[model samples]
Target: MKILITGGAGFIGSNFIHYWMKKYSQDEIVNLDKLTYAGNLSNLRIVENLPNYHFIKGDITDKKLLEKLFKKENFDLIVHFAAESHVDRSITDPDIFLKTNILGTHNLLCMALKNRTRFHHVSTDEVFGSLKKNDPAFNEKTPYDPRSPYSASKAASDHLVRAYFHTYELPITISNCSNNYGPFHFPEKLFPLFITNLLENKKIPLYGDGEAVRDWLYVEDHCRAIDTIIKKGKIGETYCIGGNSEKSNKEVTYKILALLDKNEKMIEFVKDRPGHDQRYAIDFSKIKNELGWEPSVSFEDGIKKTIDWFSTNKAWWKSIKNGKYKEYYDKQYANH
Candidate 1:
């Protein structure tokens, strides 16, 4: 199959590319990435030389570009993962998130419909919003109650996907996954930030006592789940993919510290983010029952592997730390 993967250079997308190239020998993959701060080419070094893989540096909002590429490639499948995913960045500049997450998604959906290609959208469980202390975990049927601009924009895109599926009879499947952590993760995210901070002997910033909870899934497992959904999932359905590993920010921070043999003194509490969800969890029974797919990696094993990857790949992140990310970090943490 010839597949177009939006944001293929970003964390999860790049990992998915790696997984697919290894699993399917004859499949052709096209990567479309905007090369945003988080989208680094270094993540896909392993597949850069593969004959079946091609890279296109572009934005999803560029409808003309997307149309041109769609017509040129005539792709059979589209794995849409491109979006502005950072919650803090979304809070600081919501317009970019709205433009990319909502409008860009619409643009892709429109292109897919016009091209008559099967589209699989990768979404986050954050669209289901915060879970109350007594509330059940979010499932495929959970109503969207997005709290942050990031989640709200994604929620809008999710609605658009469903609308296109019903209104135009577009062939589509959606997967809402929980928090993902694994190798090649940008340092801006929670796990990577804490791991890199500990490596640099820097203070790990904990927002608002670090009580916010999230369900963590290893990136590879999430990719495999997506593959399963793409291969066998029913059309016009949403699947929730989660590792069933739930932990609060505080618990995760301390766990990393303990794993790295660091002291709790490395942690420093900071002001909470605007509209930070207190908790997020997912119910993955649909994917498990329908596709027989479940997370294979244990949380402990996944965390250790992630920590070791970042620990050894200092140059990969250090280059970002010294370059483009320097400005963002300076601006965001100036108060701290």
Candidate 2:
């Protein structure tokens, strides 16, 4: 199969590309990415030279480029992962999120519709908004109540994918996944940020009371679920994937400290961002029962491996952490 993977240089996308190539050695993959701050070509360094792999530097919002690529590749499968995903970044500038997540997704759906391709839309559990302390995990039928611009845009995109599926008969599958943490993750996200910050002996910022809960999934496990869905999932269906490991913000921070032998004093409570969701958990039994997929990496093991990756790959995280990231960090944390 000839596949097109959007945002292939980003964290989960890059991980998925590696997973797909390993499992389907004969498939040709074309990775399209905007190379934003979060999308780094270095993440795909190992597979950059593989004959089955190709990379295109472009934005999903560029419909002309999308049309050209669609015409050229005639791709059979499209795994859409491109989006402006950070909640902080989204709060600071919502326009880009609206453009990338909403308009960008529409362009891809149009192209997929035209080409009659199998489209898999990667989404998030945040679209369902915050969960109460005793609330059940979010399932595929959960109502969307996006709290932030990032989640709102993702929710809109997910709706568009489903609309296309029902209205146009587009072969599409949508997967709303829980928080993912693993290698090749850009440091802006919580796991990578805390890991790299502690590695550098810099203060790890914890939001508010650090009691917000999130279900964490290892990136590889999420990637495997996506692969299974794309290959065997029923069209017009939604699948939820998760690690089934729920941790509070402080618990994850302390776990990282324990893993790195860092002191608890390094954790500095910071002001929580606007529209911060209190909790998010996914009920992914649908994916598990249908696709025989489940997370294999334990949270403890995953966090240890993640810390080890950052520690050994200092050059990797160091390069990204300097410059603009420092400025952003100071601005976001200066008050705290």
Candidate 3:
């Protein structure tokens, strides 16, 4: 099978590329990434020279580029992952999210319909909005109540995908996954930021009392879940994939501290971003019962593997930390 993976250089997308290539060496994979702040080609260094793996530097929002590439590649499947995904960035700048997530998805859908290619959308559980501490976990049927611009854009893209499925009979599957953490992760999100910060002996920023809860799905588990969905899942279905391991910010911070043999003094509590979701959890039973898939990595094991990766991959993330990302990091977490 020949597949096109949008945003394939980014964290989860790059991980998926590695996972797919390793599992199905016979299949051909093409990566389309815009090389944005979060997208790093270094993640795919191992497979860059492979015969079946190819990379293209482009944007999904460019309609002409999509047309030309779709015509040239004639791909059998397209996994949509490109987006301005950071909620804090979206809060400060929403135009790009609207254009990329909503409009870019529409562009891809048009091309997919034209080319008769099966499409799968990678989404987030944040689209279902925040959950109360006692609220039941989010499922496929949950109504979207996006609070942040990033989640709202993702919600819009989700609606668009379903619209194409129902109206144009587009063959598509969507998976809303929980928070992902693993190797090659850019040092901006929770796990990477904390781990790298500890490595630098810098204080890890703990947002708003360090109590917001999240289900931390290891990236490899997420990649496997997506593979299951594309290969065996029912078209037009949305699956919720999660780690089944829930942790609060404080709890997770303490875990990192313990792993690195550091104390709580390394943590710096800062003002939380607006619309910070109190909790997010997924009910992944649908995929589990139907597809026989569930997260295999325990949080205990996953965190250790992640820490080891960051420790050994200092050069990979060090370059990113030394670039423009450092400036953005400072401004984003200025309120302490």
Candidate 4:
């Protein structure tokens, strides 16, 4: 199989590339990334020189580039992952999210339609909005109630994918996954940020009261779920993939502190971003039952593995944390 993986240099996407290369060595893969702030080619250093692996630095919004690549590669599958995913960034500037997540997805859908390639969309549980303490977890059937611009853009892209499937008879599948943490995670996200911050003996920022909850899926587990969906899932179907582990930001913070032998003194409580969802949980029973796939990594095990990765990968994260990222970090956390 020849596959086109968008944003393949980013965290989850890069992990998926590694997973695919290991499990399906016979398949050819092309990674297309915009090399944005979050995208890192260093994540794919191991596979960068592989015979079957290729990389293209490009934007998904470029119609001509997509056309040329589709014509040249004749890909069998397209995994769309390119997006401006940070809620804080999207809140400050929504134009990029809409352009990449919505319009970029539409452009890819047009290419998939023209080339007759199977498409799979990677999405987030945030699109279903927040859950109250007693509310049911988000499932494949949940209605989208996006509160942040990030989620709203992803929701629009999800709708576009479904519309192509229903209206144009496009072969497509979608998966809405929970928060993923593991190797290659950029330092800006919660887990990596906290882990790297503690490594440098810097205070880790905790938002609001640190009560916002997220279902933490290991990135490898997420990769396996996506593989299952693409291989065995029915076309036009959507699956919710989660680790089935729910942890509050506070709990996660203390866990990291404990793992690193640090105290709460290393934590800095900050003003929470607007539209911070109180909780997000996923009911992944559909994928479990239909594809016989479920998260294998428990939170206890996953967090340790993630910490170890960051511990051993100091040079990688260190390079990322310096320069422009330092500026963004200071600006974001300045007045808190």
TM-scores for all predictions: 0.98, 0.98, 0.99, 0.99
Worst 10 residues of 3 by lDDT: 327-336
Show how many residue pairs clash in every candidate, following the order shown. Answer: 0, 0, 0, 0
Model 1 lDDT, residue 294, Cα: 96
Residue 231 displacement in candidate 3 (angstroms): 0.9
* lDDT winner, 1 or 4: 4
lDDT of 1 by residue, 217-303 (tens): 999999999999999999999999999999999999999999989999999888898788998999899999989999999999999
Note each model's CA RMSD in angstroms. Answer: 0.8, 0.9, 0.7, 0.6
Using TM-score as the measure, name the better of candidate 2 and candidate 3: 3
User: What residue runs in model 1 are displaced by over 4 Å at the alpha carbon?
Assistant: none
- lDDT (10s digit) by residue, model 2, range 1-336: 999999999999999998988888999999999988889999989899999899999999999999998887789999999999899989989999999999999999999999899999999999999999999999988889999999999999999999999999999999999999999988888999999988778888889999999999989989989988988899999999999999999999999998888889999888888778999998989988988999999998898888888889999888888857778877877766
Candidate 3 Cα RMSD (Å):
0.7
Give per-residue CA lDDT, model 4, range 1-336, as digits (tens): 999999999999999999999999999999999999999999999999999999999999999998898888889999988888899989888999999999999999999999879999999999999999889999999999999999999999999999999999899999999999999998999999999999999999999999999999999999999999999999999999999999999999999999999999998899999879999999999999989999999999999999999999999999999858888888888877
Q: Please, what are the lDDT tens digits per residue for candidate 3 over residues 1-336?
A: 999999999999999999999999999999998999999999999999999999999999999998899888889999988899988899999999999999999999999999879999999999999999999999999999999999999999999999999999999999999999999988999899999999999999888899999999889999999999999999999999999998998999999999999999998888888879999999999999999999999999999999999999999999999999999998987756
Candidate lDDT (C-alpha), each: 0.93, 0.92, 0.95, 0.95
lDDT of 4: 0.95
Better of 1 and 3 by lDDT: 3
